[model samples]
Target: MDSQKKFWRSLWQLRVPNKIKHFMWKACNDALPTKENLHRRHVMDSTTCDLCREHLEDTIHALWLCKDISCVWSSLEWFHQAILVQPANFRELLARFRPCQDEYKVEIFVIAAWCVWNRRNALHFNRVVSLVTSICREAVFRASNVAGVGVIFRDNRGDPIGAMSMPVPFGQSMVEMEALACQRAVQFALEIGLTRVVVIEAFLNGSGQLASFENILGDIRFQAACFQHVEFNYISCACNSVADALAKKASSALVLQEWLEDLPDDIAPLVFREVH
Candidate 1:
């Protein structure tokens, strides 16, 4: 286990440069499963998808490919070039997703997924099934015209890191943007050759008691696994503001990928764009 971890750390260090990036890769407190979680997994019921009986009613089928969803894709020509989206479960689907290097594509993918999720919720709560073509068209349009996006990450100081001021086509909830920041932070850590990290997020959904699991973070499972290593903490808005601003910076300039340098002029106008 130690050797395997070492390999991951080296990789992360190569990807990230700052202490905040390291924290994301080095401390993953969210990964720890509690008795409640372990107990629930043991009760997983049989029978595949409620909608699609053939396959397991898991994340991948519901999000990536389903009979009902195909109509949407066909109408919208979503997979125009033929890139398969086959995920066994929701986690797998997210794991398999590689954010498009193309800013436009990336924005589209994120918004599309969120839309799909929202549509699903509407179906569950309001009995509304969205038009597949509509979803696809909206996905493309929203992605391209995204006014801004948010990216969150954490630093060694147990501080939340994020951005929230890029002009995007649509609006992103603070929670959604924070999750993006966490993902990006882990990616940066991976680039600098670090394996483990602690990502501090100020999320109402987070579980934990004042700082421990089962209090603040609501999606402990996601917050934990997304990073190679991670830790979750509840932070005051005052401390979290800096990170949120950073996410806005990254989102504002979707056209440019200014990976490591002073943020480009487009992204710089927003607060907290600097990553050094």
Candidate 2:
């Protein structure tokens, strides 16, 4: 166990992107982007994509531009107009998005993309494929309605802590995304001076799971160890609605995060309305 810890410690010592390195300035919050999660709960398609045998079956091709995937891309008539790219790869595809000046549209893209992928994974595993257009449509709408804030603190655990709400891309780079998350987490950690805390999400684009915090980039290493002792966990969207609602309204309010043990009474209606 000690050796394993050393291995990750070595990675932190190694070189990482400069943009990510700057993330250390953050107070050590724990807001990680969804990590890669192509593995399955239970699907029967060959490990290789049925349509694109060149690569393993995964979300990238299914959502990007496989022949089967092309239909989905072609159908995003409205979104396509927002940015322009004939992506030969994922980098180009994401690059096409310019963080809308207001930052709200970027949130829509991130959250909706997560939902779209969720629906696709469901189809692949449960044989519940629905029209691609419908998925995109719901995603677009939910982008506007879906709400949740990731919470990062410096201590609640016996030691240290950090946490934050996930940020929307504002014509920003992936490195920028990591920095934004790290900044928020660090800010929270600095606020309380504990060793560890929780970073919960109301959304995921398959970046990182709730409890799995590793290699999350930035030269500083993990946020949980910011001071002494920190940890993380996940909550379902239904459970997260509380934070989501608070975050959306709370964002403009002069503070970065607001914590609650459960959904607030007044906001509960907004979540029900959004879902309905």
Candidate 3:
């Protein structure tokens, strides 16, 4: 236990943010005030796990030992290895990661742990439970800041041309943003006199949005008709990382900004990866 304490104390030395370190330290010390702890202190009568409702809540159970948490861990590619080396508690879990040289993996674990805790709180207090995939994706999104939209422009021979991304405006749906991004790309193509061009977007397939689906599609089609050759292609978000990064960049924009050569240092690596 003393050795574990040393391990927990060493976590502050990591390059992670102080907020995360504080949360992790609290988790290590069993200081999160889980339902079981609160109930023991007469704060509440029930000690049920808000997510599963089948067991008493504790820091370990709420963060890691629940069935819902198991599902979340199993959803990740690293789950097999993680489970093989599973620890007895959240502190031990974090301790295992402390010696890992890979900062990115450590970041993912930290973010995922935080996500699980947040989801547990939401369910307990607000009666809200998000899907497991959404929770994991949220962790990845927050850890990687990979929530933006990125667009890569290509020439007729499918050669690399240009790429741009802007953050999605607050309160805008992804589908709405997809349509808007494609529209903007088409308008730009027309402006630059590129008569033939293709707009590839992630997650736009004319499903849902019954009322104005066609109207949106019709608008895109109308815009494409103005060009001599235009095509709309749907690709998985994984294949659209650069464009996604750009959209994330745009989400923080007060006004639309164009980047021809001076891509921001943060997103330059993603742009380079896409181009290469």
Query: How well does candidate 1 match the true structure in TM-score terms?
Result: 0.34
The regions of model 2 sitting more than 4 angstroms off are 1-167, 170-183, 201-216, 219-222, 250-276
> What does candidate 1's lDDT look like per residue over 99-128, in tens digits?
334444433544565566556656646686
Evaluate all candidate structures by whole-model CA lDDT and list the values in order.
0.45, 0.42, 0.68
TM-score of 3: 0.56
Candidate 3 global CA lDDT score: 0.68
Candidate 3 stretches with Cα past 4 Å from truth are 1-6, 127-130, 144-276
Writing each residue's lDDT as its tens digit, candidate 2 over 109-135 gives: 444444455555565568665455444
Q: Model 1's lDDT to the true fold?
A: 0.45
For model 2 the local lDDT of residue 127 reads: 68
Alpha-carbon shift of residue 24 in model 3 (angstroms): 1.0
Can you give the lDDT of residue 125 in candidate 3?
79
* TM-score on alpha carbons, each prediction: 0.34, 0.31, 0.56
Top candidate (lDDT): 3
